[model samples]
Target: MKTIGVVDTTFARFNMGSAVVDEIKQHVSARIKRVTVPGIKDLPVASKKLIEEEDCDLVIALGMPGSKDIDKVCAHEASTGLIQAQLMTNRHIIEVFVHENEAGSDKELAYLMEKRSREHALNAVKLLFKPEELVKQAGTGQRQGFEDVGSIGM
Candidate 1:
């Protein structure tokens, strides 16, 4: 029953962006709102809006890569000269904490994300956030993603 908020920086690609969003929607079952603007700006605003409007239990920002792995965006300051231009005006990311702390660590990423999502779900349960409504969403098969996402942790 946890209301999770999600923001994605993949929309600059337009149709492809929306398609990616659709896939994520299926995967996360979280509240997602279309955002304008380019990269980092869209993310922070989307994150804030989703939290405020959805009363979200958690906020996640998603960024797609044009020429590199998602991790690379957080890895080198600039993967290539072309990316440097994008980073300058886009997800500037002067210091992305997740990358700075977790990079090259032995931790299993999928597991961590799942664990985090489950913790949010559990918190929603503890707060008596909205069991019956969530149950109905379950009836429609939308309630299982968070559990599966959390399973990535284990």
Candidate 2:
């Protein structure tokens, strides 16, 4: 069985991490190992350790960046670190992020965060075992809230 590593933050509202874990479990039959950090900036190291030391087959890194300019910058830095970790470990990392400013109100943000995290968790499972499903959806507008841009000819 595959082992899934989940890395989440405590700073987000609405318990988005738990929503993500629940969604992942619905689609995958695997061992789930989770690590919770204090904030978004800490996700990279925890994810790296989960992959490098904990022997996980895949990783889901979930976080909610604040609505400030500095927060966005910090998220970018954390993402870069995640990329580096992926290269070092030769494994896939699904970095799921929901910005606080994406919604107009606290309630909306909470809903959006939960929805986005669950969607990305499903994406992570697909990436690990059924990547062809994702490729089939390219340019089809099958994703929620996204428009079909049409496929490009190679």
Candidate 3:
């Protein structure tokens, strides 16, 4: 069975890890491992550990950046680290970052978190089991948390 890792940050207001796990369980049967860190910057190492030590085939790194310039910078730094980790491990890390400023209200923020996490979880499943599904979706403007913009007419 394949192992899927879920790395989340405690700094996030929502429990995106649980949302991802729940979505994954609905689609396929795989070993799901979860790790929690203090902040987004910690996601890279946690994800690497999950891949190298826990034998995960793929990872979903979830984080929420606050609505501030410094937070955005930190998110970018974390994203860079995640990319490096993926290069070093030669594995896929599906990043699910929901910036606090993306939503106008608290309720919307929570909804976006759950929706994005679940959608990315399904993407992970498709990547591991049926990558062709994604190929079919290429250029479809498939948004996770918001309404999909749809494909443009030729």
Best by TM-score: 3
**Clash pairs for candidate 3:** none
Cα lDDT tens digits, model 2, 34-138, are: 999998889889998999899999898988899899999999999999999899999988888888888899888877878777887888888888999999777
Model 3, residue 5: what's the lDDT?
Answer: 98
Judged by lDDT against the true structure, how good is candidate 1? 0.39
The collision pairs in model 2 are: none
What are the clash counts of all predictions, listed in order?
Answer: 4, 0, 0
Model 1 spans with C-alpha error above 4 angstroms: 10-37, 65-154
The RMSD (Cα, Å) of candidate 1 is: 12.5
Question: Mind giving the per-residue lDDT tens digits that candidate 3 earns over 1-154?
Answer: 9999999999999999999999999999999999999999999999999999999999999999999999999999999999999999999999999999999999999999999999999999999999999999999999999999999956
RMSD of each: 12.5, 2.2, 0.7
Candidate 2 regions exceeding 4 Å error are 141-154
Q: By TM-score, is 1 or 3 better?
A: 3
Taken over the whole model, the C-alpha lDDT of each candidate is: 0.39, 0.84, 0.97
Clashes, model 2: 0
